[model samples]
Structures are given as structure tokens and as C-alpha cells.
Target: MTLSTVNPDFWKGRRVLLTGHSGFKGAWAALWLCRMGAEVTGVSLPPEGNFSLYDSIKDQLTLNSNFIDIRDAEKLNAVVKKSNPEIILHMAAQALVRRSYREPVNTYETNVMGTANLLEAMRDLAELKAALIITSDKVYRNNEDGHAFRETDPLGGDDPYSASKAACEITTASFAKSFFNDKGIPIATARAGNVIGGGDFSEDRLIPDIWRAAREGESVTLRYPGATRPWQHVLESVSGYLVYLQALAGDDGAHLPKSLNFGPQGGEVVTVGEIALEVQKAFGIDSNWSLVNSAQPPEKSYLALDASLAHKALGWQSKWAPSETLTKTVEWYKAFSETPDIYSFTLSQIDEYEDIS
Candidate 1:
């Protein structure tokens, strides 16, 4: 269940093309790859927020970062062709649910077409050994049932964001079967749970919203307090992807599963209200939340993932429990608020995670 399966030597001098390296999860992956001594080329738009993990570490790390949209097939293909990456990790997408509702076209273009563009671009790259397309646990159909979704669960989504990711799963699978399989290239899709961690300044997310409310000394708004999610640290999810990629590197397209779920253990599944309370406790702040009584866009009331396939296939499992995940998140924000050197603080957290995982 630990990160012993991640071989550091396997990444040294490896050519890796990472899309969406400007986002929260992508930044963490970029840093991890850099730490492993991988020759990394990051492609994505510039960081959206003023304070971003990508901005914090981009100057220090040796990464060839390109500011381009994944939806642009021409530009994406050019970058992919030039990099000639052996491994491609596609993380770029319109990730926010609320934003997806507001910009459905953008969501589909970025998540669905963006995935197709990445796969299409890979067709010319004869050097491509493997590719891991990052999708969401929301890709699974949720009927408000409490059952944890496995990799075989039917792909469905009610919201724009989830639907786009579900479409991505289908797109990746089609590409894998129709193209990559014949070319001896292994391609897989990773469905990870609701990821929470440091350096996430994104809007609408529970942790970031709570942190912002607390800092402003205002009550936080809860859209779906009773909604339950399978939560895990950023490191846990990133480690799962790394382990899955490593597995794909050696295997042919025949044996590897087309899709794998990477989520926390059973104990880590918790309600939104419970996580809010946990974050308040961790931050030593008085709990104040106001429920949105108005009608809003529909979202899954309950979501969890069964990552048994990843555990059995790649020897990967979540390391931190939900409580520790919240604690570490609070600590990171607190450190950033108090200290000027966020770069060092973020690196220390990564080092600590590796030590224990």
C-alpha cells in the first residue's frame, strides 16, 4: 500500500510530456517528476491564480514549460512532436463542476476533445511507450446509491464536468483499442477520487473555499453538505498515477486494463459537512457554515471509488486517511500564510510524504 513500488531509478533521464502542469495536481506531478530526475516538458496555459504552486516552483525546477491550450490540436501536436516524449500524462481539463455548468461548451472542448487531441497527437510520436489519461471518479454513474464504483461501473455523469470526463474515458478507450494497441503503445485512463492537498487555490472546492472564508472571517457556504466523497491527499493520487505509469512502461497493450480507479480506503469516505468540520478543527477556527437553500445545478449526492484493481495490478493504495489529509492541508495553508518561502514548505511536504508512503 506504500510507495515502495515507485522506482525512482526508472524515471531518471526519462522524457515525460505533462499536460496541465499549471494546475494544482499537475504542479505536484511536475515537482515529483523533477525530483525523480525525469526530463519533463509541461504544456498548458499559465497559472490562473496569483499564488500558484506552478508559479512557486517553476523558476526553480528544470522543466520546459509551454503555455498552450490542449484543445488546440495544431499547437498540441507540434509540442508533442518536438518533445518526442516517451511518457505522456494528460491532466488538462475544465475541472470545476460549477464552472462546467456555466461553461459546458468549454468543458466539453477541453475535457473530451482535449483528450482526443492528445491521443491524436501521440499518433505521430513513434517514441511514445505509454500514456496515462487522468479522468475523475465522477465519470461513474451515481444514482445517489452508497455503493463504491469499480472500474467496470457504467460510465455516466449528470453534470457537464462529469459528463466530459466520462466522454474522455470513452475517447481514451477508443484510441487505445483502435490505435495504440496496434502500434504497441500502452494507453490507460486513471479515475481518481476527490483530491485535496496544499497549493490548491482553486475556487468552489471545499478545502480552498473553507480556507478563504476563514481568512476573511466570514461564514462559509455549503452547497451540498450531505454529499459524501472519497477524499485523499494529492500525493496519494499522484503516487497512484506514477505507479500506474510505471506498470504500463513494461507491459504490452494486451494485459493492461484500459481503466483503473485510484481512491482512498473505506475510512476516507466522508460527507462534505464532516470534512468542513474537520478542516475547522485542524485550523483552530470556529465552525460557521450556511447552507444554500436555493436550487442549484445537480451534483452527485454520494460518490466513492473502489481501487482494488490498482491495488492488485500496480501495488498502489492510499497512504493517508481523511483526517490526516485535512490536517496536512490545513498545515500547508497555515505555513503559506505565515511564511514567505512557500517553495521550501511545499517541497518539505512532498519529502515527508515520500518518507512515510
Candidate 2:
């Protein structure tokens, strides 16, 4: 069976409090929730980088946004209490690996402590039915293999950013054991790899950097041209998260105190150079790119996620293939390139994803 975009009434009148709703993936998820007819309350800091997807859809969606820091437990707790949300999706964190290297302390505080603060705040909320904590595929220790990372794989990270995410995973498991399992909250952790789509202007990411370079008539730079990853679209990961939530809300036994990995379809892994070539073709640009001249930070050479469990248990697999995902990404950037109407473009994609259901 294939996965389709969910119907609007599926989430009608449901309340969802999403932290870090202003980030790239979070913004896309927020727009989709609004389309699915959920009352969405967004809590996070203001947009920091270029044209933000959040800023684009703030007025269009039924969003109650509050500018605050997740690290501040007092503020976060107050907001969680006020919302009394039935579903919670925690996406707030310092997400960059290179940046984490630069600010290790901030990374730990935001990723680990921020998670603990949210779980603590939700502890007393009796109405809360399910909570999905968004972590990274990087949480697993990579031994430079093309094989996929499994759910029960060893959770360890060499770098500050990945290590901090690993810490969050441990905290989540401990919290679920200590309280959630018996309390019937049924918390789950999500780890998805290399999600790419529109409206992302973050640093140190591939698609955004490629888009920027192509727009400026310059070639993209690659530090690790041969590195490989599980490249999936944003909606692919979003669909898995929604299905997991649906299972948790329906049959608690299905998702009780568990962790799941969402990756692209089997045999979908592609090398960085191949993806760059596809991106160039999508952009229709003859622009060139080369390796970095100076030294670069060390990163894993290869990493992938074993999504077989998600397929077997949740019946969830990637809806869009890698080529389709890259095409969609290029299309979004092309629309923004021709006319920088980020708000309209973001809403259109949300509608597009929902219509697939």
C-alpha cells in the first residue's frame, strides 16, 4: 500500500504545540498541520537567516506564534500549560554540525537541556496524548559504511552536534521509562536523514548552498564530493512522522516508548557528486563547482538509515524518490528565484503535499 497525504478532517479541531516552528523543516510541518485542520501554536525564536518560511505563512495559517527560547524552562512550561495541547512535536534545537563544533556549550544546552525542559513541562499535562521528539540520523555512531543505521544500533557521536543529539535520545528513553510508559503518554523519537526541500536557507547544508551558488552564476563547492547520504524530501519524512502520530494516538501499544528511523526507499542512497549533478540538471544551469581550497572540518564519509522497521511496523515508506525529491527542490528554488514570494510558494507546497492524499 502507498502512503498518501492525510485528509484535513483527520486532525480537525486537534491542538498541537510545535516548538521550533520557525526552522526549515518545522515550517513545512506547521503548514501541513494547518492544512490538516489542526490548531497550531508555534513557539520559538524569530527567523534569523534569509527569507523565512515561517514569516511567509504566519498570517496565512491558523497559527498562534510566540517568540521565545526553548532553553528557558519557565517560559516553555507556561506556554505548554496555556496551550494544553493534545499532541506535541518538539523540533527546536541547534541543528548544525559545524556550528555545534563552534558552540558546543550552546548545542548541548539547547538540544539536551531543551529536551529535558520540554519533557518535564509535559509531565503534568494529563490531556497530552502523544509526543514525538525529532532527532537526527546523526545520533548513531557512523563507522563509514554504506549500510544503514538501525533503531537498536549503538547511540554515540564523535562531534558536538551529533553527540548532543545522542544525549537527547538517552534523555528521551530515560524519561519514557521513568514516567511516560505508565502514564500512557506513549512518546516516540524520530530520526530522519538529509531532508531537502524548498525555503531552506541554512548554512552548511547542500541544497541551499547549491541554490545560492546557482542563482549567483557560481559553481557550488564540495568539501567531500564522494561522501554519500540518504537524501529524502521534506514531505517524505513529514509523512512518516504523521503516520507515527496517528498510530500512537490510536493504538498506544504500537508506538509505546520506542524509536524509529525514517529514510528514503530501499536502494535510494546516492553519493554527493551524483546529487550535485542532478541538482545542476534540475536548475538547467551550466554553472560549475569545485572542491574547497582551504581545509574543512572532519565529517563522516558515509551514512544511511535502515527504514525497514518503519516499513514493516508503521507501513510507512518514502512517497517520493530521490530524483523526484531533487526535482521538487529545484522547482521550489526556481519559483523563489523568479519571484521571491516565499510566503505564497510555501503555502503552495503545503497544499501540494496535502493534495497527494
Candidate 3:
């Protein structure tokens, strides 16, 4: 019983429209898809922040790059029409939880309505066969009772980010049933766990926070030391998405489920504090962290996902254990700090992952 991989033969010479290609996960996906010989048309806002993975490696990718807001329906529709893609991977969103608190309206607009915009734009593309809407594991209502959420679990959330993603899932499902299914296109939404990897310089994330602390000679402040999350490398979930999309485009794909979950398999629950210690060990630095004494917004104390369906249906399993994931993640940050050819290092990591997958 071996794990499956993204078939490069299927991707060769395929037309793909990838939104959010300027973000962390999107950048990795763009590079991988291009390496597999897919002609990618990228639609995303220009990279923000001084240090972004996309900015570091954009020059190395050969995509039809366009910088536009997904919220702009007219422009997005124009791009969709122009691209005439066979497959679409929609990952654009305001993806930070803490920032969603300050700008809840913007978050909802981007996660919910923005999803609708993409669906609307692509529905009429005669060449389209399949699409995957990327959501988060946090879309489920967290009872915090140490329950592993299944695909059939009730959807609700307290924070703006999670709630908006839940809404996005619902919206995409509606479009899938009402439009895509009728049009003979297999469209599904995928919920993934907390993805950690190199090149994620986004604010309010674990690995990037730790890297910043090491650079500044200070300890990263912890908001929820006791909270548990399902952690996996970004490529694990990305490859899962690619594999599932290929399945959907197959002859029997229309009979597949409309939504699937991708997360680390089994009862591998590690707390935030424990992961912090492991990452510091990989960095060869002291486990330096202290709790923030000030009041902060509420967060889930325990969260996990049941990826049994992905295993049964797609035969998908996470290849890297927590230790290996941490080692590779830390190694990437170190490469960024010490080396200049990040594009080459990133490609090597991708090749390493493919070798094992």
C-alpha cells in the first residue's frame, strides 16, 4: 500500500489558472506546476511585505503573471476568459486570523464573495474540467473537546477568518451542485490543516515568527501555548490538492465526493509549545518563548482533522513525520539566510519531497 503522487504526465501541456500565485503556498504550487510542464496563468495581487517567498522566486517561474484583486469581478472575469483554462486552483484569500479581527468585512468579502466571483467567472469556460477551492481546517466549529472533525461535521466558527472560510466552503458547494455538476465539471472544496514550510513570511504564523525571533535575538511571544493543531508541510496538502484534481478530471471522478479533508494522519497531536521546542531544536537555538501577559483575542485550544476519507478515497497520506518536517522547514529558512539562489534551493526541496512521496 504505497502513497500516490501528482502525475506529471497529466499536467504536461495542461492549461491551469492559479489564483493567489503571489502568496506563499501559491508560489510553491506555481513552481511545481511549471516544472511538470503545465502552462500556468497566474492571477494575484502583487506580493506585499518586504520579504515574501513569491518575491524571492518570481523571476524563476514562467507563468502568465497578472496582478489584480480577485474582488474586482470584471477584471477577474476578463482574466478567466482570456486564460481559457482546463483546471483551476483558487487559493486567493485574506488568510490571517488575527488580521481578520480588525478587518472582518474585508475578510468576508475576500473569502466568501471573492470565491463566488471566481466560480462565476469560470462557469462558462468550455474547456474547464475540474477545480479545487482551498479552505482551512478551522472552518469547523471548534467545541475544543479534542474531537477530530470529519467532512460531515457541522460548519461554524467564531473568528471572522474561520467563519468566512466556512462561508466560502458553503458557497463553493452551492456552485458545485447548482452549476458545475450540471455543466459536467467536477468542482470540489478542499479543507487543509495548518501548513508550515519555508518561505512563509506572513505575520502571525509559527515558523516565520520563530525565524524573526532568531534573527532579532529575542524570544517569540506565544499567544496560546497549550493549543494543539494538525501541522504538515505545505507540499503535503498542495500535492493532495493536485492529485485530487486529477482524479476529478478522470472518467470516474464525477462520482467522487464534493469535499475532502487533507491533514496529518492518525493521532499525532502536538501542542504549540511542543512544536516550538522541536523547531528550536532544528534551528539549534534555545527554546526561547514566553507567554504574552496582555489580553488577546480568543483562539481554539485544541483542533485536529480526520483525514481517513482522503486515505480511503485517494490513498493519500502525509509522507513526512513531524521531525522531518521541522528539519526541512528550518533548513529552508537557513538557506534564505545564508544563500542567494533561493529558487534553486526551493526546487531541490520539492524534488526531495517528490522522491519520498
| The best candidate in terms of lDDT | 3
Number of the candidate with higher TM-score, 1 or 2 = 1
* Top TM-score prediction, candidate number: 3
Q: 244-287 in candidate 3: lDDT tens per residue?
A: 99989999789888888898878466889888988877776775
Between the candidate structures 1 and 3, which one is better when assessed by lDDT?
Answer: 3
lDDT leaderboard ranking: 3, 1, 2
Please give, for residues 122-161, the per-residue lDDT of candidate 1 as tens digits: 9878788899999999998888677899888898999899
TM-score for each model: 0.97, 0.95, 0.98
Q: What lDDT, from 0 to 1, does candidate 2 have?
A: 0.84
Candidate 1 global Cα RMSD: 1.5
lDDT of 1 at 208: 89
Rate residue 343 of model 3 by lDDT: 94
lDDT of each: 0.88, 0.84, 0.91
